[model samples]
Target: MPKLKVKKSAKKRYKLIGEKKFIRRKAFKGHLLEKKSPKQKRNLGNKVVVSYSDTKAIRKMLIC
Candidate 1:
């Protein structure tokens, strides 16, 4: 059987922290920054953990 490779794109998009937790970037920070509030922009810059439901699938893609 062929070895399953971890997806490089998924590796870049999500980071494994501690053990089971995956840290990810917040969306909506790409364009039209002027229209968003300062607070909103600040909040979007933080890294957050993926939801419990998504962690299982993401783990497979990441080969964790």
Candidate 2:
């Protein structure tokens, strides 16, 4: 059987912590920073865990 290849894009973005947990960066941190308040920008800088519903799919793509 052929090896199952992980998605390169997901591998670069999401990271696996252990068996099930995955870490991801918060959205809105990439653009429009000029209009966002300082507090909002600060909050966006924080990394967040992926939601339970989305974790499974992300894990599959990020398998490494």
Candidate 1 lDDT tens digits, 1-64: 9999999999999998898899999999999999999999999999999999999999999887
Cα lDDT tens digits for candidate 2, 1-64: 9999989999878887877888888989898799999999999898888889998788777664
CA RMSD of each candidate after superposition: 0.9, 1.4
Worst 10 residues of 1 by lDDT: 14-23
Alpha-carbon deviation at 29 in model 2, angstroms: 1.2
Candidate lDDT scores, in order, read: 0.94, 0.85
Error of model 1, residue 29, in angstroms:
0.4
